[model samples]
Target: MKKPVIALLILPFLFFVSSCNRGKAADEVNGNEKKQTKQLDTIVKKTALTIDTVDYNKRMVAMSNNDTTGRWPVKAPYPLPGALLPYNRIIAYYGNLYSTRMGILGELPRNQMIKKLQGEIAKWQVADPTVKTIPALHYIAVTAQGAPGKDNKHRMRMPFKQIDTILSWAKPINALVFLDIQVGHSTVKAEVAELEKYLSLPNVHLGIDPEFSMKNGERPGSKIGHFTAADINDAIDILANIVRKNKLTPKVLVVHRFTQGMVKKYKEIKTVPEVQIVMDMDGFGDKVLKKDSYRSYIYREPVQFTGFKLFYKNDIRKNWVMYTPAELMKFTPKPVYIQYQ
Candidate 1:
């Protein structure tokens, strides 16, 4: 009876030890599962960080359009974060709010202009379907005048109230605003400095017209003007400074060009991560002439990006019709910026 009683006690102790061991094994398994989950989460975060570069490469490929010329995606350093180019296409209405002859932005009534711009945006969306199309009001903040202004610069600076009006309009539609400068006899640095207040805004960008740059002692419309690489670099420097100071996203700088002489030493134009440079084909003509001009000036001497302008009255004067978004998309390396005047 004593031996049986001892045997029963030993059996209970043995069962307890076995149960303890099983519990320890379960705890170890759970600890390992938690560690594995943490490691997987880290890997997912790493993948998320690389999405910007991957998307940039894909857009470059799409912009290339399988061209054999090798000039479409001009090799350049990747832009800093929050860049607008190559990701979204900009459709801008070019004009001064005061002049009806400049471009569509001022040609129509306020309500009518926004409605027209929205229609154009929709058309581009349908044509591309992949890229997002955004609207812009490209205001001529400093317009080149036939007569010399008070400063003898032959450029009229618009009032701040007008720029404020543009901002007011852009706010409701989420549209970008471009302050275009036709420097006339004045320097780019001077004109750009005057507009620094507006340019400091997040949505306000810049456009410099080489067509009226006027380096020599002649009037703006007397001859087609030019801007050297050095002049363009000055504008870039100012924009970069503004971006860093305000902790703003990158700014887009559009340089208008049609002839080879319009932008001298195009190869030497510097592009910074803070500023995106676009060499725009601003001449208005029939489709063939415009394409040839783009091939000669914009395509030959590559910039960070390219833009194409369509004149409502001028483009149709010879061609009898405007080039549709579908037709323009067929060009090599597709223009990411479209301006209508």
Candidate 2:
């Protein structure tokens, strides 16, 4: 009889233990679910900057902060033009021609070049007062040791006289200029430092030629060099600081993308809310086919601004279809500048 009573008491103990275990398991499950929910919330918050849309052609939409109530946020419009300006049709007067001379002559006679370039600017102004001239900086040579030259011998550095000439010509026109630096043997930061004076100018800009920025034993034109996302970010940081110090309008940094690998780190290129960066499509080929290339490249990339190059004599197709100013305005991401070759 005593044994039976003990067994009954043990049964109650077992039931109580089982109930406790069940409660503990339920609490653990609830805790795990809360953690998963928190993780999902963090991921959604981090990806807030990314645009989410099924349509590729539609204008990019962004989230904006809410008004005073801070309850409902609004969507912001896309910043760039979706329809790029047909650069070939845009009038080329003064600054346009001078920009072309950048690569050919590092420095032209200031008196003659400026006078001629300014006259072209005046003529264009007369034709259309509202149109702004997109200025260019010419690429002279790489800082590397064995860049190809007109002669058989290697050409490495740009002469001081050429730098001086470019600066002198730039001062009067109140025009934007770019100091085209070929990063060969030297680092981009070093090259920028060497031309600090020019970069300091309000109207001056910077251009990098990855074509010449190859590692040792690499030859220009045979294969293009790569720029890291970090390298581009570093350059932008430097340029942004300079622009801020000078209290100038945002500086323009131009990058040429002829292949997929040229600017692989393009996303790493910093976005200074103030500066304008242009990724120019530099390939020369069929007009109709090239348009497809442009759409693929521009739409896929993170860049908002783009530039197109038109060869005056070399392009086989004449009377190419181009977007008018009105059409250009319709772009979801509008291009503020245009370039001609």
Cα RMSD of predicted structure 2: 16.9
The residue-by-residue lDDT of candidate 1 on 1-341, one tens digit each, is 01223444454655554555554678775665566556555555434333266678889888877778777787877776678988899999999888899999999999999999999999999989888999999999998889997888898999999999999999999999999999999999999999998899999999999888888868899999999999999999999999999988889999999898899988888977789998889998888889999888888788878899999999889446778999988888789999999
Best by TM-score: 1
Structure candidate 1, residue pairs in collision: none
Winning model by lDDT? 1
After superposition, the stretches of candidate 2 with alpha carbons farther than 4 Å from their true spots are 1-131, 137-155, 317-334
Model 1 spans with C-alpha error above 4 angstroms: 1-51
- What root-mean-square deviation over C-alphas does model 1 reach? 13.4
Where is the poorest 10-residue window by lDDT in model 2? 80-89
